[model samples]
Target chain A: VARPRIEQAQQHLDSLTKPPGSLGRLEEVAARIAAMHPEGKPQIRKRGVFLFAADHGVVVEQVSAYPQEVTAQMVLNFLQGGAAINVLARHAGAEVTVIDMGVNHNFDRQLPLLHKKITKGTGNLRRGPAMTREQAEAALTVGVELATQAQRDGIDLIGTGDMGIGNTTASAAILSVLSGHAPEAITGHGTGIDAATRRHKVAVIEDALRLHQLDPTDPIDVLAKVGGFEIAGIAGLILGAAAQALPVVIDGVVSIAAATVAYQLKPDVVDYLFASHNSTEPACRAGFQILGQEPLLDLQMRLGEGTGAILAMNLIEAAVKIYSEMATFDTAGVSRKQLP
Target chain B: VARPRIEQAQQHLDSLTKPPGSLGRLEEVAARIAAMHPEGKPQIRKRGVFLFAADHGVVVEQVSAYPQEVTAQMVLNFLQGGAAINVLARHAGAEVTVIDMGVNHNFDRQLPLLHKKITKGTGNLRRGPAMTREQAEAALTVGVELATQAQRDGIDLIGTGDMGIGNTTASAAILSVLSGHAPEAITGHGTGIDAATRRHKVAVIEDALRLHQLDPTDPIDVLAKVGGFEIAGIAGLILGAAAQALPVVIDGVVSIAAATVAYQLKPDVVDYLFASHNSTEPACRAGFQILGQEPLLDLQMRLGEGTGAILAMNLIEAAVKIYSEMATFDTAGVSRKQLP
Candidate 1:
């Protein structure tokens, strides 16, 4: 971040007609965006949602409510523009692209989606590693390459989302290993699971953690052990967006897992990342704690497909407009604080 | 609220592609909007923001940070489309109307604004009644009449915002009387007042509450004693929106104060109202507690001109689209949970 530009943005916002800092989070968001640009002006002209789809071997443990094949089905639903994320991204004027990282199914046709599958899915974490270290690195590299392509495509901002049947279990396992929190504490009902299934999901994550006592500093080792391909891809996108000075918005739990991996891999990556909303998922809160950031909206949304991120992009745009469009007190002839 | 449609909305939402209630408050908002319409479908085609501008005599007691004239100046700022509210409302595709409700100043010529001045301003509550019971009623009636006109104009949704230099002081006083909370707890720094001035503002509200000793049940009596004209107008517009079955979004502290009055006047009006965002003002929380409702956003915004409400309208529109646009599980060829 351009640290000095933050101070400059604050000074500019104070001169606006409204009370100093009375805009609250809106002002903070605007100033943060300003600090991102070289000219100290924040503008988001084009936005995109890079939704990565993959399959989780952990689904074999009966951790998720939906079937494993639902991941590919939802990807097709997204391609057809019949999903919640498509509707929301359209409302927010953002484009949606499905990045096929490692889903268990195949399109087997020329589809309007990125096909970069890594062997249909990762191995089940309960038995051993989810994927090899090389596979993890390849997924991450693909994500970085995709972000570079987006930058070339003139995208000003991008959001990360994930779709995998048991990805939340992988997210919980990652959070447990990184944050050293108990599985029960950071595991939640993913895609509407019953209480018994939630307990089982926690147990499944606990088993994974026990099977692979991952290193906190080795983000790649951790991703290779218990993380989904989509999780690694998300982390790579975060790193790539940070590398390119492009702002990235992190969505719900799966994205948070990716963010946790990215933050550990490169701590400075936090500067370019913004949390979209407070997801009801427990790992989301824990991951945000590790990032030391607050999510913007608190609507308790847990759906991932970059839906929450798209909703928050509207606020970020509004903040930029508030900073750039609103007149100063001098220009508007508004009175200043009396007896301040 | 058409209470049965809430269940119908739930049932219908569950059949969509995503998991049941995964959208969180978005689902609740869509359900509430669905319940409002007889067809059990939610759609927000035309949204408008009704902004009320007035003046408060409490500025004489040194309770506000800004001079009273800033209210009129900001209103003109809004009229010029250079205010934060104007920018945000335009972004959200919502139209804004300036309603001059006893703003202590006159345009004297025709302007593109509503002229519903009840008086020069409300009398200082520390000394006596802010306005007569008849004046408060008149302000509220004008608000209702405006809603009726909006209904004729095909506005399906409306939002309430207030602009008055010292309106937050009156709001704190009203909340103190109605919620039985002490002024020291509910009163806050309005419009960037210093710490010492905030303490003084609290003392001023405390003095007004003591001078009035208002009845909690008698909303009109309470408004007559301590509330500002804009607050009454906001309350009136809320009541009018409820009468017309039009959804209304409540903005910040001043709008909360008016909502407190209207909710007390007719408790059923909450069915038609949605708290936009949790304001930085302490009184807004107290008011929402009274209404037994939770706000949709938590951006910590305090800029009142319905800026928060306008930002939230984008989400509401997204929620309606999610409810009406997304494909069902059968249509999308997606598998449901294998077992409950």
Candidate 2:
């Protein structure tokens, strides 16, 4: 039933009276939604962005130069609307909610913070599993709850973004497991790390994989063993969004890894996923390919503060508007013939 | 006097609260404006984007696969808000007005059109000068008038974009003479032309330069010989924007060439100019250096429909809002230093 509805949406999009495939990946998203609700018009009236923040215990391994404190600092930056994500979100006309899935610091209760701590950050993933299976489930449950609540508040399009120090290493590990690639092929310099540090980070990821004896077949199991709480939460957000037939715009590599895990859990979930942009990170391209999605923007961006997702949000609005507006060529009374 | 204003603006931007010199080229424009009006705050409240559309007579030389009619077709596309520039401008919150500077077609009277034809698009430059000095001046005057009207409408920013087929060949020719480089160095595969067609385009430009005996030192002489009517007009627009103390965001290689000519005319005009992005065109980077301006974005974009400028417009708004709306440390009562 879901497959036919998805096909119906795509057929309606193909008939929308513009140059076929001119809108790029946006056309794919519009079609996917059209298929989701074949009986009604596809609409994105209310949009919500979920910013999941956590601390990565891999920072303890000196993989990143920035202190774990920067994660909390950036979370404050987001709350105060001082980050690039804030500016882009305001421009995209989307409401943003920051969730403290698992941060090391004690946050103020009045800051609209959602307390969904799986653990006081993950255990040092360089040594063993970042979080237990039970902890991963708890974080995923938190994400599910957040998405359900957003849907109740009338959100039809949900975007996933994340904030954490040294999390890119975790994302690379997850990508390797999901894409069946080696660590060297996916690991990259995150947050201005030098070449030597990058090599060390890759080694740490490879070491952790061997220690945990992580399986490539089960993505959630791999994530539970090596991913940050925020990454697991975002994966759950992707699932929750798809379960409700809402679209999820995945951000950079970390969010991409999350979406990959969610898709592994439910292949049908990809019917509701749209990749926002290609990150400079090599892992991002592999992740996008694994999910069979093409990113809309390629600005060589690697700053994973949801900047790519925010930039791609405007195009989604344009796509949906084209679906809803723009009279057909028959109505516009313009000839389709090539000019003489 | 303009020199002092530019220096003052640069110094003021340097003094702003943030990482010093971290904002890159954006800080340069803010500083130039500070120098322009030492006592007044720099403001970019109202913006006008001029999209100059024309067809190159050189296209008749078999230098391009698409006929000249595609120029007019794209112009119509711009007016209908179907082009990439239209989408980006809508996101940037700028009003776009298309000028039919020299297209060889009669637009319907009912359609929105600005007729400033210069000899129905200049005679093929491969034979001689693309246009007469008088015709070039007339086209430039049209641009001046447009800028004056934008000023009257309370515009504080002016941007230049163009839609002319085969203009890259002309731009490469002009850039070669202006930058004292050979044509081959500046020329690129414009509009995805085949390798064979590109060689022909390069040869055409070289022959045109030799036939005209264009002097590299004289900017106006070089422009009259190889520049498009729209290119000259854009150069005039940059001067007009600078004359009014408004920032002018330049689009791609063509717009950068205009900025170069404008700077040559009045070095202080560089104060009001901002390079929107570093184009993939080799000539554009040289033009930026020649004008002593840096681009806000470096996306390797070569699309000359003002898309780059539109992308940067949002960043400008963000920078200004930060400058105007962010509370000072004293006012916000937030500690600037780390807590003891």
Candidate 3:
């Protein structure tokens, strides 16, 4: 990150119409974006929300509230601009890209989507590895390619979204293996499951963690062992955004799992990342703690289709507008009033 | 508020292509707006951020970080569209209105603002009443008139902002008297004061509260004794918005004080009020708890220029857009395969 540019932006913000640092996190956002530019001016006009879709074999254990088929169905919903992500992305004027990473169902070849399924979803995670190491690598590679495609399309900012049934279980399992948090403590109601089902979900994650014994030191081992393909894809997207020096607003639980994967691989990539909101999913809190960045909003949103991310991207735009449009003390002819 | 309309909107939201209640507070916003309209559909396209500027006689006690002159200078900044409120309101596509209720500094007759100076600022609260009861009523009438003017101009949503140098001290006094919290407990650095100055500010408020012997049950007496004109103006705005059946997005410290006054006067107005963000001011937390309404955002923002409220208006717009534009499960051919 351009430290000098960030400092310059803060200096400029202090000279604007409000008290020093009174704009709070919005000012930090503007300063962070200022560092992204060469002239110390923040510019993030174009945005894209990448909605990765896949399925988890652990649905056989009823770990999720929705069925595995809902993943492909929601992918179709995204292609039709009918999902929650599409609504929010459109609100933010961000383009939506639906990537089918490893959905069990096959989408039509002409569905105006990227069909990159890896092994038709992974083995039932409660029994064995979710996917082989090579499959996980391929999923991450897919995310990187999509992010590269976003850059080629002149996207200045990118957001992460996900749609995969039984994925929260996969995410909680990943967080448990990596962060050493108990699965029962981190697991939550994915799509509003009952208490007994939640307890069962926690148990499934525990069994999967015990079965895999994934290496916490290696992000890839953890991802391949327990993470969903959509999760791995988001990890790839974060790394790709970092490589391209574009800011990425990460969404809810599954995306946080992906962020954890990306963060473990390269801690420095945190600069290019923005935690969108505190998801209701407990694993998201654990993931945020591991990633070490505060979210912009806390609306208790946990839909996980980049809805929170896109909403936050709008705030980023507002922050940048304030940075660019607000008159300085000299221009406004206001005194630089400060307390002694 | 129309409870049936709110329930109808919530039902509509559940039918959309996401899990029930997954959108969290955004869903609540949409439902609330839906209750405002005749039909169950939500609509809040027009927004106005009312910036009420005044001065405080308590500045003689050195309770604030800036000078009393800053009240009028910031008012001029608002007039010239150069203040933080101007920048943020422009970002939200909301209109900015500068109301000089009692700024002490005389703006020219031709300055495009509502110059309704009640007493050229209130008396020193540490020694005596902040204003006569009649003067407090006049300040509140100014807010009601502004809100009514907004309605005449087709603004469907309104926000409250404050600009008075020592108003936080006045606000702390009002909150302390009303909620029975100590001056030191709710007092904070208004415009970034030093520790000794903050300690002195608490002492000043304590002295003022003691000198007034204000009635806790009577909000008007509280306003007349300790509140600034801008605070009264915001209280009137909240009441006016409720009368017009328009939503009021309440801003930071002074606005919350105004809200507490409004809530004390007419508790049902809480339905029309949206706590925009959790203000960093400790008094604001007590204010929210007293009002019994949760803030939409918690960005640690303390700038009281309706910055947070305007930002939150953007989110409400997003929520309404989602309500209006998203496809339903039936429309999108997605099964409502929710957990039993």
> What does candidate 1's lDDT look like per residue over B189-271, in tens digits?
77778889999888888787878778999999999999999999999999999999999999988898899899998999999
TM-score, structure 3 vs. true: 0.97
For model 3, how big is the iRMS in angstroms?
1.6
Off by over 4 Å in 1: none
Residues A1-340 of candidate 1 have per-residue lDDT tens digits of: 8788888889999999888888898898888888887674678899999999999888888888899999999999999999999999888889998989998886966999899998799899999999999999999998899889989999988998888899988888888888888999989998989999999888888888888888889989999999989999999999999999888989998998899899999999998888999888888788999999899988888889899888888888888888888899999999888766
Q: By lDDT, highest first, what's the ranking?
A: 1, 3, 2
CA-only RMSD, every prediction: 1.2, 5.5, 1.6
Number of backbone collisions per candidate, in order? 0, 11, 0
Looking at model 1 chain A, report the run of 10 residues with the lowest lDDT sum.
A33-42
By lDDT, is 1 or 3 better? 1
Worst 10-residue lDDT window for candidate 1 chain B reads B34-43
Using TM-score as the measure, name the better of candidate 1 and candidate 2. Answer: 1
lDDT of 3 by residue, A1-340 (tens): 8788889889988988778898899999988887888664667768899888888888999877777777877888888888888877776788888888888986789998887888688779889888999999999999988888888888988999988888888899999887889998899998889899999998898888878877888999999988889999999999998999888999988888899899899988899999999989998888888988888988988788888899999888888887888888788777666566
Between candidates 1 and 3, the one scoring higher on DockQ is 1
